[model samples]
Target: MNEDRRGLLAATAAAALAAVAGPAKAQESETPAGPPPGTPEGNPGDFDFLTGEWRIHHRWRSGPQSAEWLEFDGEATVVGILGGICSVEELRIPARNLFGMGLRLLDQERNVWQDHWVNKNSGVVAAPGEYGGFTNGVGTWSSIYDQDGVTMISQGIWDEITPTSTRWRQRISADNGATWQETWIMHWRRA
Candidate 1:
């Protein structure tokens, strides 16, 4: 509808896609040694692979149920906090006047991560955090969200990560997890 609403929706999708896989960080520095103090037994360094500036290639549908595709570019910076147990990603998409950040925290006992997105314009959390983890090199996070009173399942995934690039996608299912419609796709490259 209006620009702010449109930007908010776009920011949500961008954050979702960005959560799947962060852009490849620079060689940068080396990690401190073992896990940080109070670190959980799970992989504390789950997000270590993505910590630096990255160039983002973004694609998504006009709406959660729309089939039309839109393309744009964005940039992101990923930083590891609490010694890799937590991470924060800042996203920028000026074409749509969107800016936001994603904060991710890991659960040591359960080994799942809770990823959250926050919009800068509204200074509010985009939605409830998605909880999940990576298995066999693929990560999938899913959560049930209520948008305007409509219940929907939101899923974000990181697929095909490599030294220089990776793929990420976001999908929503209206009926549990039965059928999913891809809402966002992102390709990240080292910047």
Candidate 2:
């Protein structure tokens, strides 16, 4: 009777172990091997130039404000946040008391850059616009606004860049690009 009791206890323990382990083993087998979330799988090289910090020197003038110009120091940071689908850039200008955020995304099908921008003061965002791809290390976008009794059209271009710095220009045309009134030109040094 003692030997039978011992044998029964061993069998019960083995059965419990199998019952617990069976589901876990099956789950592991069913899981598919795939790339991790937010991993950049395609065309990651297109936006690689925008992944740094920069100190910007901005200059601008409009209409009769040409002689009495506005100057300010600003900064820009572009990072691959949020699933690597796009890059977000934050720009800060202390002299003009302005700050802005911009989003840049590359459309694989269209082979163009989709650019969006917003200003802190106005709280208005520019509409979706297409950029003529980055070639010779340059890209630009422009928008027109008629808010607060001011008809202002603005254009921004990333003209040049190195490992540690970038040069950008923000030009505003009150009378359209036909007679462009250069509003802000800035150079950014890496910080």
Candidate 3:
């Protein structure tokens, strides 16, 4: 096998260990007190499952407040870095002439993940990225954003995970978490 195969196998093994060990070992030195109820403590290799090429089915609105939905197909390749403590996903949509990168870093000290998006056109890391971790097999990372001068809560959810496929949804709400409108949704399958 080549180096890529070796690295992926290593990442997969590390992820298995983390899942079996739970968060106790990872959080032992970081904080004696666990995260507030319902929050999952992040661990290294949490994103190892994403370390591979993926075919993405994308759906999104034209604008944050737009009701019209557009669909496209894209491709993505995710790689594990920093010993699985970090992962980078490169996304490409040739039809739309759009490309972007997603960086997910594990905050070992805080036991959470910080997710940032970098647009190819801007070449800047978007400020105030979402922060959250997996709980009961579902991962939710969220942050606050200002949309048209109104404060909105934005969430990126990873669910319906399987060995070969997963679903990601992005939703926003101006009224706290009382209501949400899905802005983008993507179905990812191993490519």
Candidate 4:
């Protein structure tokens, strides 16, 4: 009798464990973390030119002399992260006492790249993600960012991209892109 009771208890415990774990296992199997099955990938190697260390010359303007470009020299490190699904850039400008980071990811389903930017000044990864891809060797990405309850469009363009150097610019439009003003530009060379 005791042997039968022990067997029944073991069976019941096993059933209970399976019941608790069954839904979680099914949920995981139903959805995946990466690209979905049959998801067409975006342009492979579109950002390959950016996957290296670089000496960066930055041009930025704000305030009373908003139209002027105040240039500074900086260093940047770019790495192919997330198994090539994304790349990250770390930038430092000692003269300006500034640091920034950019994370660029390719969405297979959307067939576009999303660029996320953040800086030490605001400490907010608050920039709306810019989404675009290279066309005819030129890349453009834009997103809306908020400032003091005002909506702004941030547009970025990559021009003169080459094996060792590239020129990129950032512009902001307060009037829904009807007009754009260049706010930042960077000239990057292989370091």
Candidate 5:
């Protein structure tokens, strides 16, 4: 190529690179906003208690009208990330050929945590997850969803925490949180 042509090409490439890098440089310098004034701060290590391998005892109901309880055994592994600001749980029931994952993320700015679940069958992350934060030593998260054209609420609680064991239970409310029916419970022992 001619000298002029080469010079023009170099300038054009430099301009293009600058266009891409300028905004990224600005973004790098900007810090994420924290919780608003008067909003409580969240503990980054809130999920640290659950980090480890666990043997799970599961008791679940088939549906809202189910009278008989089904009991099963499962295993779970919990991993803490980002200094416990985020955690993931992998639960497997080999006998039933079931696998599921739960991901919990803290929204530092909002001072709350969101819980998401992904079933192996679908391999999709459920969005707009249940939101809550740890209170004392227990964690409670809840969400509202439509069930048979009715607005139903679902809640999950983590309690009975100890060094070697913990208990989690799920409840559903058809009356807008006025009443709750326990549907599933799991006991976790360190494995």
Candidate 6:
């Protein structure tokens, strides 16, 4: 009888160990953290052209200064952060002599890009804008804002970019959307 009781107690202990270890073993076999199924990894080549610092020259034509040119220097830096969800660009221009930061969030679910911009001087941000998927490696964004009682529409396009340089244009429309004016033209070269 004593031997039989000892055997039964050992059996009970073994059963308890099995019950506790089963779930842990199953969890360990489960899939580890990784990119979601069907989600491709981000390519460094896609953002290579924006890797370096840039110097910008701006020109514009409007009103009495119509057809006239204004020049300024702008510096740009692009960085990939937040698990590759977006790339943030910080630009400084000595012309308006303002510093601004913009964020380009890449939505993997919708495959679209959303842009947000804020003026550092006045700490005001215009309405956020969304652009469709990139085509032929080019994209455009525009926004309207009232600055010191002057209504200004700002438009920009990124064209012909490589890992080293990108061509960008910024234009302003004063007369709403009916009539447009080009206020700033900027070409960014890697520095």
Write down the lDDT of every candidate, Cα atoms only: 0.70, 0.58, 0.77, 0.68, 0.73, 0.55
- Candidate number that wins on lDDT, 2 or 5: 5
Candidate 1 error regions (>4 Å): 1-42, 125-128, 146-151
113-185: candidate 1 lDDT, tens digit per residue: 7676778877654433667677778878777767887788777888898877888899988876788889999
TM-score of every model versus the real structure:
0.73, 0.58, 0.77, 0.68, 0.76, 0.57
Q: Any runs in candidate 4 off by more than 4 Å, and if so which?
A: 1-42, 118-128, 145-151
Ten residues in a row with the worst lDDT in model 6?
31-40
Ten contiguous residues minimizing lDDT sum, candidate 4: 31-40
Instruction: Give model 2's TM-score versus the native structure.
Output: 0.58
Q: Is candidate 3 or candidate 6 better by TM-score?
A: 3
Error of 6 at 41 (Å): 17
lDDT of 3 at 4: 72
Cα displacement (Å) at residue 145, model 3: 2.9
Better of 2 and 3 by lDDT: 3
Rank list by TM-score? 3, 5, 1, 4, 2, 6
In candidate 5, residue 46 scores what lDDT? 83
- Candidate 5 regions exceeding 4 Å error are 1-42
In candidate 3, which residue ranges exceed 4 Å CA deviation?
1-39
Please, what's the RMSD in Å of model 2? 20.1
- lDDT (Cα, 0-100) at 41 in candidate 6: 29
Q: Candidate 2 lDDT, tens digit per residue, 1-191?
A: 14453344335334432432357767477433322222232343555666666677877664435566666677766665434446666677776677876766555564455565566676544544424345456656555567568787666677777777777776666765567656667777877
Among residues 3 or more apart in sequence or in different chains, the pairs in candidate 3 whose N, CA or C atoms overlap within 3 Å are: none
Between candidates 1 and 5, the one scoring higher on TM-score is: 5
Error of 3 at 157 (Å): 0.4
- Best-to-worst order by lDDT is 3, 5, 1, 4, 2, 6
Question: Residue-wise lDDT of candidate 5 within 165-188, one digit each (tens)?
Answer: 999999989998788899999999
lDDT at position 136, candidate 5: 75
Worst 10 residues of 5 by lDDT: 31-40
